[model samples]
Target: MSNKPTCRWWPLAMLGAILAVVVLTWFFDGLKPELRLDMRSLPPGAGHWLGTDTLGRDVWLSILAGSQRSILVSIGAALIGGSIGVGFGSVAAFFGNDRLRFTLRAYLAALLLLVVFVYSIAVLWPTVSSTGHVSVGISILLALIAFVAIFWLLLRRFNLLRSRITFPLDTITQRFIEVISVIPRLYLIVAFAMIIPINMFTLIVLFAVTSWDVMARMVRAEMLKVREMTYIESARIIGLSESKVFFRHALPNAIGPVATQVCFTISGLLIAEATLSFIGVGVSPETVSWGSIIHGYLENLQAWWLAVFPGICIYLTVISLHALGNDLDRMCHSKH
Candidate 1:
């Protein structure tokens, strides 16, 4: 029994560790460790605390340098995911029990299609204009195909609404959340990572896209509770606009759960990024991440420092984020 509180509180110390890592990484961001062929696979010593990797880059320095991108990607993904989840979840909460002409799945599909459209243009325009690649035509054609598919779905949705068909938005959202939850995130990662070049941008977009549904579910639940509160009603009765009411009052009350969800998302993303790097699917080969340092261990087991140090970084970071998330979740539940 005495150990319970100690176990619970110990993770708080990790908060300091995370802060230190962030600061260290930021300080060293512009200083990437160069390859030292003569010093390859050296063990930890005065010159190199974590030793050198197969490429002879200082392992400790590599971890610190790579950490900046990984940590930033996780935080960026969580922020973007949280924003999207809050928007969608709030909209669902507003129309909740009332039958709605629109469905979340349709909404999601349309939104995704629009993103694909815009992203494809941004990516292809340069190639088509300058390089004139045959692949650009194929990409443009594919984008058009995706647009047509979404248009068909929207057409059917229009027909249903025209027929006076309506659905309980809450039920639709819950079922949509379940479906999104079941679509194995790793599968999406593999599918996209294989097709698209994996970099900081792609990783952030991938992590953000896959992480939002759970957050949306949490936000929706919180919003439901907040909507029934006396203060929320008072705001509405005082002629405050719905958007202002939600942004000013409802979002604040509902933000706790979303905050907890973001921490969990970050924890999961850190592990995922490491796993991707381990499998050689992360950022470019030159990009030295903690996982990339650990990847060297597979080559030479004798270089144990290659794996151990970076592994410690990943493990400690994930643990810190997970523990923090658990604490936040507990606090939110207890207050509710």
Candidate 2:
């Protein structure tokens, strides 16, 4: 009895309680985040529990309303990203050396080229559409031609080396991870936000894409270690298919850490969403989120509740999630 508050039970109970309140609030028929000009900046009292915003929106109700979508987005992104990351990373670790050996002339190179071209097009669209300059258009056309020329030159060079040597997929994957991990994920999401419309689905897509790398890297490391384990060889010798061995044996052994990683992923995505919403590009204009509530208070510090309550909500959710994740991570390591 060191008096340390290390129990894992609290987070689960706390998260459940919060979610219950949020869900019930969402379904409550009478409560809505309506604007009232006359009721501006009222303190917590008779009717409103958490006070009012500059727009006269009920702070408590707004937080509940925002939680509806915010929680949904975080959960959705976690499930999708975790699934893809763990699945691919496990498989990639096992079969990487075999399946990844290809020539520079492989269609894989062509596919990379296509990806680059599509990204370039996306980047140039706003500029071309907003300012519509002939010189700019001509310059873009020339750049595209240069890209094509460079692509052809690389293809030819790669083709020449196809017979002499094959491409190392392990190297390619590692390089990709390094490159992606180095770039700030928020910047990528912001880039996409500029090009595409922001909505729940869009946010989910963005989070899924940005959030998977950590899980993938973690799973890949675990699977690689598990790959060398004695039982994995036995499974293979018994004629189990790669997929079956992976899911039935390797994945189960390796998933505890990755599973815990999901908690952190959810926490991270929640923060990311809030950051984006604060910047005014997160959800659609009509939709409200925790970040949007805080954003509303930037100009009007007098309405302190606008920032404080939602900040409390976000702090509780994020910290509870992190604490749970930390406990889970410790449990996972202890078992090993």
Candidate 3:
């Protein structure tokens, strides 16, 4: 028999420390991130612990405020996206017939292509309408409406396909996953942002939509493996319903990978949020976020503190999340 591997502690320690900082920052909400003309662009000193931005806002206060927003958005995106991925993936793997699986795979592929096309159109909308014949806003609105309509149609079709199961697996799903895997996610985000009016909620939605495919694929892979186990077969043999066999016997065992996927998703979403903000397309200008804070100082190279403090916060938070995910993944493997 193999000896159980001992769990590492530093990941948990780092995660705890990061959470503590975030919580502490939240409690100091009284220190509002308002402007102070007298202290504008001041270096770190007795008056401002982290210095002041060009707009005279306390850097420390901004960092705290930004951290709160970033964390909330990241957590929200991760939870929503992870839930979606797990649900869709588990259903496809366990309940899907071959025809249903093929339809779903086709839908996913079409969805990817739709995203790319929409993003491209959004990016070129302004240039294409240089003659002022078409309003950019109207173009964006139409594009968004089209995206929604297509998505709804695909969903309706998926439901219809689900009603008629033909086979257990489809190679098309794997091909769809591979196609999506090769696309540049950052470019996709930037393109989407160009067409959409970005706010915190919109950013969260964007992250959730784009990031869910990976989580779904992960869950699907795990469920496929688990469903083939002897116990699952025995449960089926004993006349357990497919739903029961899936939810009760297979799903619970497959959760470890899902949990790890969620952790990593949170980190990736946070980084995506930051990148959007850095590029001036994430949150609204009025919203306080670490990415926005860093972006504000881009014009003034000497305002190093403005960028450094928030950059550090983003770095630490993402690293902590990644470390925690690694630990969770290791624990999951050890159990197997």
Q: What would the C-alpha RMSD of candidate 2 be, to one decimal place?
A: 6.8
**Clash totals, every prediction:** 0, 0, 1
Q: Which candidate achieves the best TM-score against the true structure?
A: 2
Candidate 3 steric clashes? 1
Model 2 agreement with the true structure over 16-110: per-residue lDDT tens digits: 98788667867885656888879878989989989987778788888878887778889899999998888767767866666444554555456
Better of 1 and 2 by TM-score: 2
Which lDDT tens digits does candidate 1 get at residues 143-223? Answer: 777776877677676664334435577776778778777887767877765555567876788788778897888788878
Sort order, lDDT high to low: 2, 1, 3
Q: Better model by TM-score, 1 or 3? A: 1
Q: List the residue pairs that clash in candidate 2.
A: none
The candidate with the higher lDDT, 2 or 3, is 2
Better of 1 and 2 by lDDT: 2
Worst 10 residues of 1 by lDDT: 1-10
**Local distance difference test values of all predictions, in order:** 0.77, 0.78, 0.74
Pairs with backbone N, CA or C atoms under 3 Å apart (clashes), candidate 3: 98-167
Best candidate, lDDT-wise? 2
